[model samples]
Target: MSIKSASLTIVTPNLADTRKFYEEHFNARPVFDCGWYVVLRLTTPYQEPEICLMSPQEGMQAFTGGAFLNLLVEDADELHSELTEAGLTPMMPLEDHPWGDRGFGLLDPSGVIVYCYHPIAPSAGFEEYIIEQS
Candidate 1:
């Protein structure tokens, strides 16, 4: 089956702050916004994923500590520079990874990890971990 669109919903206590943080940092525009729920999207022609923010539900467990949003970009270094120039500090400095990624990470106001990355040549020993596609 072909997929039309996809979105990731993050339930947090700080919905407003999380929504505002995405708006400011990613140039996201609100497609829908209520007090409890907000959907934001980047201003792009291609079908990018939507980011949804919502209030925590009653009786639900606390936020998942290690959940992260990964955004693959064309130029991660440029985006890193832009983020830094916008007065935001990265949770992790941009660096090349053994798994063939050059990226950085940041935490939103609600402590959600956002990783911005782009693919690069894999490091030494990458071939050992490579999985052949079926």
Candidate 2:
């Protein structure tokens, strides 16, 4: 069967702060917002998202860092500019990847490593494979 895209649920320490970080920086708004969990996404026109902020427990150390997700954007540089204007410091500057994604990394309010990227070119191999489908 054909599959769609993927979105990762990242358990965070502070849902509000994490939510604000994503909303202000990446324009991720809540599709579902409960006290313990939330589903956030970018706005219309560019609607695919790759990460979500959720809350497991207040201090589950395992859920704190590198909740290990990448968020694809139309232009990482433009997002960076917006984030800069919003006073968020990028964990890394935008850089070119040999693998074809122009990207940078950052930390969410809850300490998750978020990679913001735009594909510079099609992926090297597996042209037929959609990551969400594989």
Which candidate achieves the best TM-score against the true structure? 1
The TM-score measured for candidate 1 stands at 0.87
lDDT, residue 98, candidate 1: 88
lDDT of the candidates, in the order given: 0.85, 0.73
**Candidate 1 at 54: error in angstroms?**
0.4
With a 3 Å backbone cut-off (N, CA, C), the pairs that clash in candidate 1 are none
Each prediction's number of clashing residue pairs: 0, 0
Clashing pairs in 2: none
Best by lDDT: 1
- Residue lDDT tens for model 1, 1-134: 99888888888888888888888888899888877788899765655579988898788654666778898887899999999999999998999998889999999877878999998878778957878621
Cα lDDT over the full model 1: 0.85
